[model samples]
Target chain A: MAETVSAGASGGVLGGRRSRQEAAWGYLLIAPVMLGFAVFFLIALGASFYLSFNKWDMLTSPVFNGLDNYRDVWRDGEFREALVNTLAITIPHIVLRLICAMGLAMALNSNIRFRSFYRMLFFLPVLTMPVAIGTIWKWLYDPAFGPINSFLRRFGLPEPEWLSNPRTAIAAVVIVLLWSGVGYDMVIYLAGLQTIPREYYEAASLDGAGAWQRFRDVTLPLLTPTIFFLSVIGIIYSLQVFDLVYVMTRIDQTNQLPTVVYYIYEEGFRNFRMGYAISVAWVLLLMILVFTFIQFRLQRRWVNYV
Target chain B: MVPKFSTRVNRRSLLGAAGGASALALTGMLPKIGSAQDASAVEPYNGEEVTITYGFWDMAQEAAITAQLEAFKVHFPAITVEPQIVPWGDYWTKLQTSLSGGESFDVFWINSASLPVYASAGALLPIDAVVGDGGVDLANFAVPLVEMYGWEGVQYGIPRDFDTIALFYNKDIFDAAGVAYPDDTWTWETFRTVSEQLTDADAGIWGAGLQTSWQENYYNFIYQNGGQLLSEDLSTSVVDSPEASEAFVYLTGFFADELTPTIAIQQSNPVADTLFPAGNVAMLPGGSFRAGTYGQADANIDVAPLPQGKERATVTHGLANVIWSGGANPGAALELVKWLAGEEAETILGESGATVPAHAGLQQPWLDANPDMNLQVFIDALEYAHKVPDPVVGFEWQIKIQEVVIEGFAGNIPAEEIGAQAAAAANEVL
Candidate 1:
């Protein structure tokens, strides 16, 4: 009996050692990714945070400047303009995108002919690069020689200057962003629509419900989770809009379409105010964080996880 | 629990191996520092096989610059020069990051607009000692450009090439309108009258493409009208002065009168450059650097002196070759800069007709490269050329001024009001 107890204790020690070895191997397998995250993301993020409180011109060593950069960001007229423009573009973009995407997804999700072909067609814009899309759309909105203007002239209608006019420039940019982004959102919604069991609709029909009534009672609730997901992602993406705005507008016209990220770029790279740009970038981060938090809080009222 | 008799030594060895592997991977990814050679001890052409990198922005000039580099090899056979071409959009950002990171090129191209920023930061090596030791004559370059690259009695750069604006006209449109060809004797009134005659609204052709740009179009007018973009001391903005308002009125009148394409139309369509070559515009004031592209286009084009406003004035800007302060090989870099700014490289650059070399007497070759156009007009305009403003906060002020001026041209506000606003905004930055 004494020999057997000693043997059992040795066995338990061996098992513990084996499990610990497994844990080490698991960590080893993930080491590359962890290292990459530390070096590229974590280190850079920390540096940016540190630099926000200093004065740097990107050519010399940074000098400690306390909250001067933050103060400058608040006082800058261009930064205020950028903030207002960003909100104007992002809010409408999310609402219009959700509506248009849901409509397209509903049509495509129905028992229609050539559904895959239609899906491919609708998803084509998402595959094209943003720069290419922006460039092509810029030409399309050209006031004098664009096809849109030509069509307007054919109809004997006055063609308003779309991009050059400050009053219409932001609207034109929103149109381009919507054109490029709606495809991705529609694909997501279509995926969501397919997950709804056919029995739910059939039962609603058997109960003498009309099409709109069935959609309101069944499809809408089922799609709320997807809508919630997209809204969160869309808000974050739209707030950081840069490449499209940069490609579409010149500095003179940027007031109409300026975004916080683009302003950060102009300050850091063009104006050589690296520290100030980082400070503005931190403000953008805080704004996005607060917005995302509010979204999470609001989702409880409307989002249906089931 | 039943079969826990495995070897404990094996697990210990495996953990050790994993830790070692991670450490190895991380060490590979960390940035290596203090690896550069001690360049101070190395004399010029001491039979050392030193490799130095040269960074420039223009891809179109690569072939000509490559040829120049090959010629440079003949003088310093042991040294190898690697020419890196960063596109214009990303050049400054990359240069800034690399310089701050201590991995910058040995030598790079700098511009008048960027001179003060880099020079003041001590990121550029002052080349006065090198110029003096080599007995390189600064007088060989255009005086304005030499003065442009200088800051606080220290010359930081050697001018590689210069550009001045001139009138580029479509000969076919001129003949069709029956307007006399523009010449040196033409005044502002003559230009206005000819532009009016050349305008054909029914045909959708404009007399000229009047862009809202400050450098290529309006700055010349401002200087000609005795209005300075900034005070002589570079301490204040004087764009609100009456003389500047007159210049603004003259420039914006083209759009207001519909003689040129509306600001909206020009903003959408090809502005002056494409409009002129596409035959949509009869005349355009463009920089000499555009000569190559304009020469290649399928159009009967010619250049003349810019039509005089109150006086004959043009804005001149140029690229300068400077040595990086962080370079590992200052001696070799200085040698390369001197060779590039010398007569041979300038001759090669001029012969290619890529740009007007800043070397004073070598411009004739650039003119001869394109005999079909009056390229000499650009050279002559240099006599009265005003250096584009190069204040410490130049890029910021320039962008602000452009914004207000574009608003004026778009007719959102009156020209005088725009001028005053622009001056106020610029002065705030200054």
Candidate 2:
């Protein structure tokens, strides 16, 4: 018995030979994916990193021009404008998305009629193609012919040109971003909500807590981890917005509806400044890293794994 | 996706066209074909069974292009040709990535705007073989069009077709408004006054839909106003002149007075295939290529001379077939390029009514394709049409000009400040 106990402890849960053979097969099965990752991701990452230092138009051979591309990015007024626009989008999107998702998750988590249908309805946009989304919304916001403007006109309200006006374009984009993005956050929040024990709510109720009080004391504290995860990911992804902007409102990269990725695209492909675009991409990566680091540092104060 | 109206590329000006003196001088310097026995033959097809890819935009022209290729098959049966048609918006993006990755079509359509940039970058294969004995004659095509494809005396492309800008007006609207059709008699004041007379805002109709394109609208006006976009040397922007400022202010009055659709409405609804055909606008200053689509629309449309400012001027641009330097079958590609530019293929292209063939004397068929419309106005305008002035760097500066021009059209920039701002913006990019 003592020998068997020692062998079990030494071999983990499986027999030694069986485990070794399984491990070997597991590695063999995963080798192709690993090779793909190394070739496509790792190698490309290194090449792009090296390219960030060189002056290349992708038509001719790269010439090593250290720090010049980076210096150009630092002074790029378009990039600064793109950053401001991205933040303008990211902050409001994150806040509104969290609130809307939490509200949806809570409503769906209760004994609501047709709960599954409502949940699926909200999540459908998440599954739809961004290009399709942009195309539909472009028509929807069409000032002359769109249903939205028609509805506003019928109500005798002012109808601002949604995608064309610089001031209102970002607001329209955020509404879309929230509509397409909130469902994903809601799904995550639903998982978080379920994890919070009913015992907490019951205990709160016994302590003479009202619905709002119970939600404040019990539901809010427990959902911090989910909120933190969503925010960090949301900022990183939203900062790189290109598809919706490119499809819906990409009028002129220098003036109207310029975003960071769009700026990179204009600089690299359109402007034929591949090296400078790579430098911009690296700056974006560093920004994401700093943002994530700050979020992680700030997480300790609010996030509760318990 | 909103279909782009300016498919007729801004052949923005071609090289060797600064003046008549340079043109004559270049005529002498053009590489001689038959004089040298050492000159290579263009037909380099071996008995090898191989395939070559030909990429282009404009699916509307596929049938004609295909018919030409089928004719190419009668000569070289061993060569299998594949046609890749990417949309205009994605064509350049795909071209860049594919060329960089060493996987691109053997031959593709190129324009003056991109030809210089690609040639300078060494991305284009020099078609010297096709410029020599037993090949097409350089003198057979228009001098400016031919010069548009040559870089440092090495030819890189063959002119496929040409387009000139003109006024496409709804005859029904003109008749309804009891206004005369746009003709050579009209000037800037006439255009504006007629626009004001034609506009019926209560019916949600604007007089015109000025496309927010530098080539289609502003370039014509700027040039017609005797305003040069660039100096004679093509080194600096000259749009800040009083003539250009006046023209800029004149064009904006149409927009400000609601004679034309606002930039916002045009963004979602283009003037060419959408609003103009739907009878929401009275007139459109568009490229001649728009006739193919407009002819199919249920409207009485006709073309007339673009009302001149100081001179009867319009911007003419052309597309050329060029071989990619990285193509696997250069011999096959060259053979296709030479054959495509030949009279036989041009006849087929013109007969199909896809566009006006660049070959001399083959434009009659395209003209007859739309007999109702005065398509002759396009060929006639060629006399006064200026090539899009392409700098050695590229036409990317045009984008900068457009960014400022769009705001100017939106009535955001003050009239006097708009021209100077556009000049400064273009100079910054240049």
Candidate 3:
């Protein structure tokens, strides 16, 4: 009886040892990735934070000036312009993207011929670089020789200066952004639409709900979670706009389309004020965090997780 | 104890040790120790393999530069010269980052706008000692160029080539309009009259494409009108003066009168460079470097000196070759800079017709390269040529001025108001 008890104890001990060895292997597999994140991301993040409190011109050693860069950000008229422009661009861009993406996604989700082909066509712009898109759109917006102006002229309509004029430059940029970005969000919405079980619609129909009623009761509530996710991400992305503005507009045209990230780039690289750029970046980071936190808090009221 | 140590040395520990070792090696944190060389004596080439990189930013002159490099090999057989060509848009950004990283090129191109920034930062090696030791004559180059590259009495760069603005006109448009070709005696008033006569709104052709460029357009007008962009000490802005305002108004009048393409039209199209060559514009005030491009286009074009305002004046700018202070082989790099700036290299550059060599008496070969047009106009303009006004952080201020000038050209604001605003903005930076 004593031998039997000892044998059982040894068996339990051997099983425990095997599981511990497997757990060790798992940790070993992820160690390199963790180390890389530590070195490249976390360390660089800390360095940037440190740089925000100092003044560095890239030519000389950094000098510590507590909160001066941040104070300058508040006083700079250009910084104010950039902040206002960023918000102006972000709100309209998000609203437009949501409406267009949701509407197109619903249309595309139906039974239609060439569905995969349509999907690929819509996703094509996502594959193109922003610089290439900006350049092509710049030519398309040409007032004299572009096809847009030519079309307008054929209709006997006066053509407004599309990109060069301060009044219309931002609107032109918004149009290009919509053309390039709506497809990406549509794909995400389509994925969400597919996840809705058919029974929900059928049940709603049996309850004497019309098409719009069924959509409002069945589709929207279920898609709220996806919508919530997209808005959070979309707002963050919109606030950080730079590449399109940089490529589409000249230095003289910046007043119409400058965003926060573009301002950061101009200060850091063009003006060689690295410290001030970092301060601007930190402000951008804080703004995004607050926006995302509010969205997360608001999600509880609208998002249905069933 | 030995048996226990052997048991602890497992495969995972061994692999981790190796990975850490390689990471340290790859990061270049390990110290390097080498024997010191004597500082007093200059070392001659002793058949050692030395490779040096030369950075420049002109894709159009690649072939000419390659030929020049080939010629350089004849003088120094042991040293290998590698040419690195970056596009103009990305060149300065890459150069600055490389400089900060302590991995910059042995030598690179410098310009008046960027010379002060780099020289003041101690990123350039003063070449006065090298010039004195080699007995090179700095007097052979244009005085403006020499003075432009020198900061605080320290000559940091040797002039490689120079450029001046000239009036480029399409002969087809001039003939079609029944107008005579522009000459040296042409004044601003004559230019305005001829441009007005040549303009045809229905045909979609303009008399000129007066781009909102400071160096090629407004600066010439400002200087000709006897107005200064900056005060004598270069610490204050003088662009708000009445004379400067008059120049601004004169330049923007072309846009207001529809004699030149409006700011909106030029913004969408290729500006003057394409407009003149495509026959959309009858006249274009452009840099001499554009002669090669215009010559290649399918248009009959000719060059003349810029029309006079108060006096005959033009803006001249040039590129200089400067040695990097962080270069690995300073001696060899200085040698390369000297050779590239000397008469032989200048002669080769001149013969190629790529640019006007800064070396005196080399203009003949460049002029002879294309005999169809009046290339001598550029050489003549050099007599009253002024260096582009470049203060510390001049690039930023130049953009500011362009912004204000563009607004004036758009007719959104008056010239005087814009000029005052621009001057105030520039002074804040200065």
Top model number, DockQ? 1
What lDDT is reached at residue A254 by model 2? 39
Error of 1 at A272 (Å): 0.7
Docking class of 2: acceptable
Every candidate's DockQ is 0.30, 0.27, 0.25
Chain A TM-score per model, please list them.
0.92, 0.91, 0.90
- Candidate 1 Cα lDDT to native: 0.82
Instruction: Estimate, for each residue in B55-132, the C-alpha lDDT of model 2 and write its tens digit.
Output: 999988999989998999998898989999998889999998887766888899998999888888777888877775
lDDT of 2 by residue, A94-166 (tens): 8999999999999999998999999999999999999999988988988888999999999999999788767
- Which 10-residue span in candidate 1 chain A carries the lowest summed lDDT? A1-10
The superposed Cα distance between candidate 2 and the true structure at residue A263, in angstroms, equals 0.6
TM-score of chain B of 3: 0.89
Better of 1 and 2 by lDDT: 2
| Model 1: per-residue Cα lDDT over A212-252, one tens digit each | 99989999999999999999999999999998878776633
Question: For all the models shown, what interface RMSD does each have?
Answer: 10.5, 20.4, 11.7
